[model samples]
Target: MAWFILIFSGAVEAVWAAALDKSAGFTRLWPSLIFLVACAISMGGLAWAMRSIPVGTAYA
Candidate 1:
């Protein structure tokens, strides 16, 4: 379950990065919103997983 969460978080990070690039300095409202939401969810999941595992180990 933890591994799944970690992987999902990583996927979200990738999506957020791509969306941010598409946003182009916030010129695109939809992509900007997507990036913000994805990043928030990814960070929240990462924080939850980090509580039980060391940051290095969790990332690895």
Candidate 2:
């Protein structure tokens, strides 16, 4: 389950990264918000996983 969360988080990171580009410096409000939310969720999940797994292993 933790591994799954980590993988899902990575996917979310990709989504936010693309959305950030699409936002174009916060000019697009909705996309920028979406990117911020996604990034927060992704980082939170990653932080949770790091509690139990080694950073390198979680990344792997």
Candidate 3:
């Protein structure tokens, strides 16, 4: 479960990057919203995984 969460976090980070790029300096509403939401989910998953996994490993 920790591994899954960690991986999910990583995937969300990637998606978030793409969404941020598409946000057009946050002037675009939908993509900006997606970026913010994805950022929250990614950080939440990272924190959840930290309960079982070390920061370095979870980050990697």
Candidate 4:
């Protein structure tokens, strides 16, 4: 379960990274919003997984 969350978080990280690229330094409102939301979701997933995963392993 923790590994699943960690993997899901990584996928979300990819989403946030792509959204950030589209954001163009936040010049565009929609893409920037997408980036922000994705970033939050990604971090939230990572943090959630941290409850069951060791920090070192989670990072890996």
Could you estimate the TM-score for every candidate?
0.90, 0.90, 0.94, 0.91
Q: Rank the candidates by lDDT, best first.
A: 3, 2, 1, 4
Candidate 4 C-alpha RMSD relative to the actual structure:
0.8
lDDT of 2 by residue, 1-60 (tens): 788889899999999999999999989999999999999999999998888889998876
Q: Write the per-residue lDDT of candidate 1 for residues 1-60, one digit (tens) a residue.
A: 777788899999999999999999999999999999999999988988888778998876
Q: Can you write out model 4's per-residue Cα lDDT over 1-60, one digit (the tens) per residue?
A: 878888998998999899889888999999899888988988998999999889998987
Give the per-residue lDDT digits (tens) of candidate 3, residues 1-60. Answer: 999988888999999999999999999999999999999999999999999998888877
Of candidates 4 and 1, the better by TM-score: 4
lDDT (C-alpha, whole model) for all candidates: 0.91, 0.91, 0.94, 0.90
Candidate achieving higher lDDT, 1 or 4: 1
After superposition, candidate 3 runs with Cα above 4 Å error:
none
Clash pairs, candidate 4, are none
How many clashes show up per model? Answer: 0, 0, 0, 0
**Regions of model 1 farther than 4 Å from truth:** none
The model with the greater TM-score, 2 or 3, is 3
Candidate with best lDDT: 3
**RMSD value for candidate 3:** 0.7
Better of 2 and 3 by lDDT: 3
